[model samples]
Target: MIQKAQEFMNENHFADVSRVQCLLRKMMSKEYHGLIDQIKEYQDPHAIFNIHGGNNLIAPTASQAEQKLVEKPADEIKKDKE
Candidate 1:
């Protein structure tokens, strides 16, 4: 399964393996277990969704959309300056 994922990523020119790993980890969470199971049983692991710059390939999901929101660190918080 991992091998097929790697091949799919390579074939699609996915440059961020770490990002993909993070996404996979999130998908494996209990909250998404059912979705993962369904995907594992039916979807092709090699399927790719080309996004941003045509270099970033990702599986489409709500979490992927949520990840776009940039988070600010504690030190960078505006209230910290006050």
Candidate 2:
């Protein structure tokens, strides 16, 4: 779950950016959709880079996506837009 992942990262001193990679691997797994159903609660679901929304999971809405974009470095944001 997301909390477990955060705990792993904290215990290992991993940066926040690493969460994106960590969740991406989990999201890509064969059990991803099933896992969504089991995840009754979660936080920052948008942090998963390429989410596949099952019946339970919800992908970032447009405004949320834009907010994430604003958090990036200016140059990176420009490159993304390009």
Candidate 3:
């Protein structure tokens, strides 16, 4: 069933994320706890995001960016406030 869902996602290039999430929720609800775990193992977030078509780019390092932001001088902050 998960494989079929994945194939459907691939075939429908413009599928809606909310709809797919809803369908997955319904499937999960009808199953027992053990089956739910198996379903979760099969439902890969990266694969789903890729199917929905994301920017395949790696994101900038957040810690580095935050460090740079925090390291800004008081003078620089005041200048920007002008």
What residue pairs are clashing in model 3? none
* Quality of model 2 by C-alpha lDDT: 0.43
**Which ten contiguous residues of candidate 1 have the minimum total lDDT?**
34-43
Ranked by TM-score, top first: 3, 1, 2
What candidate 2 gets wrong by more than 4 Å, as runs, is 14-46, 49-53, 56-67, 71-82
Per residue, candidate 3 scores C-alpha lDDT tens digits across 8-78 of 65456568645765677676554432322332222332332221134333343333422122445535644
Q: What CA RMSD would you report for each candidate?
A: 16.6, 10.4, 16.0
Model 2, residue 77: displacement in angstroms?
15
Candidate number that wins on lDDT, 1 or 2: 1
Compute the lDDT of residue 29 as modeled in candidate 2: 67
Question: What's the distance in Å from true for residue 8, model 2?
Answer: 2.3
Candidate 3 worst ten-residue window by lDDT:
33-42
Each model's backbone clash number: 0, 0, 0
lDDT of 1 by residue, 1-82 (tens): 4435555454455355566555665756554433233222122344333244434456444344433434565345434444
Candidate 2 differs from the real structure by a C-alpha RMSD in angstroms, to one decimal, of 10.4
